[model samples]
Target: MQDLPFDIASLHAAYESGTKPGDVVAECYRRIAASGDPGIFITLIDAEKAHAEAARLGPFDRVAKPLWGVPFAIKDNIDAVDEQTTAGCPAFAYEAAADAFTVAKLRAAGAILIGKTNLDQFATGLVGVRSPYPIPKNALDPEIVPGGSSSGSAVAVARGLVSFALGTDTAGSGRVPAALNNIVGLKPTVGALSASGLVPACRTVDTISVFALTVEDAYRAFQSAAGHDPADAFSKAVTTPDLGTAPPHPTIGVPDTASLEFFGDAVQAASYAAALDTLRSEGGEIVEFDFTPFYRVAEMLYGGVWVAERHAVVGPLMDTAPEAVHPVIRRIVGAATKFSATDTFNSLYRMEALRRTCEAAMAGIDLLCVPTIPTFFTVADLEADPIGPNTKLGTYTNFVNLLGLCGIAVPTGTRSDGRPASVTLLARAGQDSLTAALASRLHRKARVTLGATGWALPEIPEPAPTLGPDEIVVAAVGAHMSGLPLNGELIRLGGRFIATASSAPGYRLYRLTGGPPFRPGLMRDATGGAIDLELWALPLASFGAFMAGIPAPLGIGTVTLADGGTVNGFICESAGLEGATDITEFGGWRAYLAAATDRQGAVP
Candidate 1:
């Protein structure tokens, strides 16, 4: 019991193997006491009450209650029933009669409430020090600023005091802290998780985020919490897609050299370069794109109308008790008064133009990878220049929500100076699962220990091929397999890679004759051996268009997999096999292509 890890997988295994939820709850308090960081939590639930709630959870029942017995903390901004909600402003505190929409959802899923954590006042600053409460120490190093306003939530998870903690991200509150504290931060798509009961920083973009020791835990918590809530007008009916196997080769976009900024930190720049190398090794093709338009969009988040949105939430308080608000926050949000209705419209117009430019910049890319924070800032640096450091900390984060993108920050490695190195994966809204799937793989590839807990990442098995009910499974033997030239056609048709599998015994694979970008033909064979192929899920509505695109010998037909299950897949007419090269013995198209490349290289 003493050696148990708090990651969701390990904790659930412990529960199944005879550890009780009461004991887990007790251990959470023990870890919190050992941490010696009172700043990490604003208001903790009584130990007896937390244990009582755990007891009510009964046994481990993951299917019915996914977060059964999981201990989680909430940022002070998000409400939990009977808790005082404070957006890091003690003067603005109020007793919440009910839980935030997402919080209630997690609680209903069998998660035990631990406490309300600290944050920047009104969730205004990226620096954790903007709070009225004592600042949370950077979990890794005391001198460094714990990234905020989700600072305490990230620290609580990093210190292993909780399995996961909820935070809000309008402009990187969720991610900056995770990167600085060496944890996983998942800023889900806007409105994917209900914002009802959360203190508004920028109501339109605010979202509840998750911090955990592992990507799997964070994603699992997300699965439990995400759904549509009619009570929350901002909520969307977005589905948390199954995270299947990573695409064999993904095209990832990186900021061009000229547009990349590290605030003169060369070590951080080199670390980012190494992180990109790791992605390349994981079968990612790195494309450097001009980030000028994106950076301009980022600037608009703080430079324009968005600040007014923040002011709208706290303006009356600012006027009543200006001194009660953090001085820095007051100054930042106060600037909102400088803009007029005309200015607001002008900024919106500019934002729309920039959004178009940024979208164009990302047209062909599957994911955008960027440094979670361009540079690290120390407490002393913030003390020296509070505004500049906080603004700079948002370098890669501020624009994400503004552009309607989803992002996750993952720890990549440690710098030579022992600081954490991290990269964020960004994609269009509702592509949360795609970025998370890749981030999970990348996190495992980095081999970094979990947060500051010294717990090694648990071994993550390759995801099994799966599909949602609304999708149709399609198997591809050659051209449409991941990394193949024609694979984009499948992607354009909304296909998600499921797995690489072998066809049921008695299938023949051949390289079709006569084409620059040749195709493959799969046919039934009475005495044939198994041939390798890939399975993907296409939306039911898009299946027709996909079938229409097939030409000549290739057409959709029922194909059997090694597991004795059948799915719609590609097959060929017997006539198309004329002059074709028998490639069944190569196992798969990738293997055949590799051998061909080797043979061609040997020619000289």
Candidate 2:
């Protein structure tokens, strides 16, 4: 076995350079045994079977199978053929006849299954210690409780035992562990990945999540497993947006000072402040919003009727094997029996009202940045007051799924006390790509190593300007460009920045006659100079609506790029150029704005 970086990009590079999959598998087992953590896996796949599967993958072919030859682990609650499907309760364990919908998709994509990882028994607890199995040690520090119920899956990825792993998230089961272990955890939108075979905790809120050493690797796994599943009634055909580039001057919402909670952990609080500063340095505008409504929504997840949904799945088990269930989990889920049908309806109504309030608070905010876990607790702390500490740990996470949001937890940096400092970027459903794009940039900027592996972060390649079949590329020469006053309109319409380029040499730029928020128009001229422009992709379905909003004299027309490519862009009629200022000498709207600002400041 050779020492290898297990990130998707690094491992694929080694595969391209002649490292065989069999060798990688051998290394995986070697690391697992050497890890000295006995609770990471509940059942290991037969080494012979895994090697045979790898051998069958043939030569490296990332195009045909994006996850070809990649090794991964699955939370035990999710079924895999021939493996015992245990929701961490041995009595509830049963042999699976077929793989879960998501599992089968990964298998088809050539990801090798390594084992079934441990989790909170029946996936009921945020603390990993609820399992009948030995607790998985925190990959970063042994004293701290390994965050759960996706504890084992996250620890495996953080410790470099697997390239990635599948974890289930209901109330931050997926993301909390990643934050604790110093890795990436992507909780995609609900129904984005099928939940057909997953042992239900809270069926309505549960989502299959990805844990990886890097944001890029997690997103790759997500893309492979994401799609509609006819077998799952909750599954929808959600399209994963293309993560083109980091949005310029993103408006990030943070908890207002009055609502921020750190649970007395000053180090973590300071770390979060630094993380916000990092975002500010990256051209992000920090907007502090009153988080009271969001906090109320979080309380509702475990405080109200949602807990009854958990009982719907495991009520039979609780009745039959009362003693078999962990005491803490039994207490939590058993409380659901006290709620009346009327209580459920009332709670649902309240939830809808809270959702509206949250939406209003989130309006105009591109992403919400929050401490992944408000504070960290140790095993000793859990033993002292299990429920209280666990509830506090979820202070920032419980409201996400309830609000139908997507989020990714990424490591910011190590705290002053040598603990992991992390923040989760969240957005409304279907904005997974936007959150990921920003998370990836922040993670790289932090310069954190890949989990506990000590491998330097891999260079993120610039995504190419490739449009999905349902998308149309448009070039923005002025206000619609990123960081400009009118850029919000394009973003609201699902437009993503692709790249910055120059128009063909035959084009000239003119500053249209307008006050306040000025607009620029491009036109073709034989002696015109190339003008800088920004390329963006908009959904084909929204193209007509976007074009209809264009005012007279400026309309969508084909414009040639310096790269010899043509795209729909803003073009002005000859009559409209009558009083328009020719700003072609400034090359771009941004340059012209900068010069104007400088000249104003130079006044007496």
Candidate 3:
């Protein structure tokens, strides 16, 4: 088997161990050229320019600069300074002055830009073939359509041409391509990656997504690229949730059998079932839910208001020179002109109601797993019924962004009939880290090799441990510390152990005057105060619920940790500690718990 060290970690290791970035760039070009796949990149960067950029990057230093020496590609629709922004439309090409906010972030993090890859014309269609330029052949099967607008980006990473690539996902463009090519596609929460330099493909719904051979690579790319961009109106300011590891026995949801649309592909259905079984064996609880409302939300995209947004994006371009656009793309974007402003308003009204319905159904599910696409179709099939089969390909995907959710697609297993089968895990917006964690586990569980190159599966990289929405680190100095009786408060809220440490060397712990839970009041002091505590991960939603039940003097607030990470923790107003007993004698929370237990003659 061919050696497959295509993930960012391995590439980083090689770089650190003295492999030159220029050499890797050369190797990448060699492999991409040898692959004989002309459809992958619409504009390949000059080798001399790429190698010069690589040479300029001094050395690997993940701390000072993550993504160091990691080579990546961007979808043509995303602006990369000096690269042609063809967007798969040769007639509409132009040179960009600066990198898109998304690309600029990656470049700042030490990623090298390889070039621009092809996409559906103006990112208008789900089918890869809806491009004036050549369609990227499916990495897994040449006869099949490499699913759309982000098609070439997906193929580029899947073929190991680059460690990762940037793709835009509006209505599954990012995810469908990943599914079709058997790679990881991370469609982060909208506004997570700034869209400043991206050509609008329905500006409201557009997001720059990442494609990589491993979940960890894709996730790391997301972390480095995701941040608030003041210049981009759609950018939102939100902390990156901790992309931590999954806990044992995770709860995953799947659409009920009646709601699953396999489009008569028994092989694909069976593959998904097997994938679920694999997840089960790995200690996941699969919950079945009615997905009708979710599908209804998806219908609102093209059938309701979103098409108008699409039309809004490219209508002017179409009117000026209709011949420049691909026929399928022209038809889809042209149809948007038929809807009136009132129709759009009605669609918006109906969509808000549908979003509520979908959220209600998803309220308790940890993660929802669905077939990335209902079925696979060939180029001939797409040629015969361009829109119908293409729409079917988005059966499990189209509704995600429309309903304000985030997702990551991972290849699961090949269908019995030999086509690739992939699954996407969806969660509410801002739950991106959770989905990535689950996708990482699923990728390892699948144990599939790299797409088409027949390269052996690289060692699954460890995702960086960080806090997630499902967890909030809290510093507790009192009875609520781990293993203490009152610790049940955290446990009941699905909290877990993180670490034991002291507050920033300037806090005092005081035993509250009274109470059954016997909470400790922790406060910052001017001098001679050092309080010990342990940090525990509490689910965000449950943390709010837990906080609501707090009594007077005790509240949730930021605590500066020894390691410099901020965590919500126990805090008390100065007044609440007036008559309290100082308990700084105990070195740490565990010792305090031990002392308390010894005093009671109980094993803690």
Predicted structure with the largest TM-score when compared to the true one: 2
Candidate ranking under lDDT, highest first, comes to: 2, 1, 3
lDDT of 3 by residue, 230-265 (tens): 999989864465466654445677999889889898
* Per-residue error (Å), model 1, residue 374: 1.1
User: Model 1: per-residue lDDT, tens digit, 104-218?
Assistant: 8899999999999999989888989999899999999999999899989999999888999999999999999999999999999999999888999999888899999988889
TM-score of every prediction relative to native: 0.92, 0.94, 0.81
Instruction: Give model 1 RMSD, 1 decimal.
Output: 3.0
lDDT of candidate 3 at residue 439, scale 0 to 100: 80
Q: Give the worst 10-residue stretch by lDDT in candidate 1.
A: 595-604
Question: Which residue pairs in model 2 clash with each other?
Answer: none
List lDDT for all candidates, in order.
0.88, 0.89, 0.80
Model 1 stretches astray by more than 4 angstroms: 1-3, 484-494, 504-531, 545-554, 562-564, 572-604
Q: What is the RMSD, in Å, between candidate 2 and the native fold over all Cα? A: 2.5
Which tens-of-lDDT digit does each residue in 158-216 have in candidate 2? Answer: 99999999999999998999999999999999999999889999999999999999998
At residue 497, candidate 3 shows an lDDT of 47
Which ten contiguous residues of candidate 3 have the minimum total lDDT? 482-491
Between candidates 1 and 2, name the one with more favorable TM-score.
2
